[model samples]
Target: MTTIERELHIEASPEIVYEVLTSPEHLVKWWPDEAKVSLAPGEPGTIAFLPDYPSVPLTVDEAIPVSRFAFTWAEDLQVTFTLTPSGTGTLVRFVESGHADAAGHAENVRGWDHFLPRLVEYVPTTVAA
Candidate 1:
């Protein structure tokens, strides 16, 4: 199995970053064009990337406020976000695993590359607001 891992340092507290990760309202600002998900573990939800793709189903596997949030989607592919405090900000470690092939893995790498930066940019604005 192939796993895609990324680390980001954002100038926001873990609690704030956690909200951005789990809240539908906050997610759309940086991730899928639309998000319909619950923070409770085992709950099912869907996120749509908009015009280009259909909604993808996902199940919340874990939600550990300010520390970790994880979900499983698309053939049991799992994405985990681990956050740790760093000075006045948060360090986010993102991991996506269970890819069946390199092609799928690479596609997600590109996808995350494009979207994760948005998270970095969006979070700070929330702090200011």
Candidate 2:
């Protein structure tokens, strides 16, 4: 299995960051054009229109508070988010494994690199509200 990982330093606590990461409202602002997600623990969320590509049916594999989240796209592709604490901020990392080929891996990594940072941008604003 090939693994591509990205790390982000966000100016927010893990708890606050986790909420933004898991909540649909926050995700829509950064990720999908629109999001349908449930806030209750263990519920599922979707980040629609996963940019620069055709539509694919993706399923949420897991949503754990302040730690990890995962989903699977077509062809057994999986994307996982792992968050860790770094001093006063959170260290967010994304790992896209289970991709069948190099093209799939590059596309996902690029898409995530584009969208995930936007999520970090919203963290401060969401937490303050």
Candidate 3:
């Protein structure tokens, strides 16, 4: 299992969804670590999850506003998040890929299950404009 992808629809605008994904403040919530990570591409960041989850040192690889974000994950994996406008809501696509071994892939699959719903829950319901 070299690649895993999941999609989520949240009741927020793309910009709002994008902000939650990139902001260090919000990332700290669902990401399960306390690290001084920046939201800019090429920046280096570290995520130290609970000991059971281990820590991942990463570099911001792609940071396009209100659309896409990608970062290096641990040693041989890259994680990417893509956002798109979906009607009055936003669509979030999360992808993980690299030369990860089976264990890495399975752990990440479980990790996403743990975190992304937190992301969906973090977003507020859309207000009529």
Candidate 4:
């Protein structure tokens, strides 16, 4: 299976970064257009891009406060976000696995390339307010 990995440094604490990554309200600001998901592990949910793409089903696989958040989506794909404290900020490691083909992997890579930057730009200003 193909996997996508990315690393980003955000000028915020792990707590803030984790909240943005996991919270449905914060999610809509960056990635999905809408998110209906419980934070509890094994809980089911859906994230929609809207007007273009259909909603994708997902399940929370893990949620460790301020450190790790992971979910399984689209039947077989799993995405994990790992957070670590850095100098006055947080280092985020993102991994998405279980891609069946290079085309799918490349498509998601582009998606993340667009969205992750929004996360970095949105966090410090919005969350700190």
- What lDDT tens digits, residue by residue, belong to model 2 across residues 39-87? 4434444445746433545567777888987777554777787889999
| Model 1 per-residue lDDT tens digits across residues 1-129 | 989899999999999999999999999999998888988888889998768767889889999999999999874799999999999899999999999988988889899999999999999998888
lDDT of 3 by residue, 80-110 (tens): 8899999988899999899548886788788
- The C-alpha TM-scores of every prediction are 0.96, 0.79, 0.87, 0.96
Clashing pairs in 3: none
Q: Can you write out model 4's per-residue Cα lDDT over 1-129, one digit (the tens) per residue?
A: 888899999999999999999989999999999899898999899999888767899899999999999999887899999999999889999999999999999999999999999999998986558
Residue pairs in candidate 1 whose N, alpha carbon or C atoms collide under 3 angstroms: none
Model 1 accuracy (lDDT, Cα): 0.92
Separate clash counts for every candidate: 0, 0, 0, 0
> Per-residue lDDT for 41 in model 1?
87
lDDT of 2 at 78: 77
Ranking 1 against 3 by TM-score, winner: 1
> Which ten contiguous residues of candidate 4 have the minimum total lDDT?
120-129
Error of 3 at 40 (Å): 3.0
Per-residue lDDT, model 2, residue 26, is 75
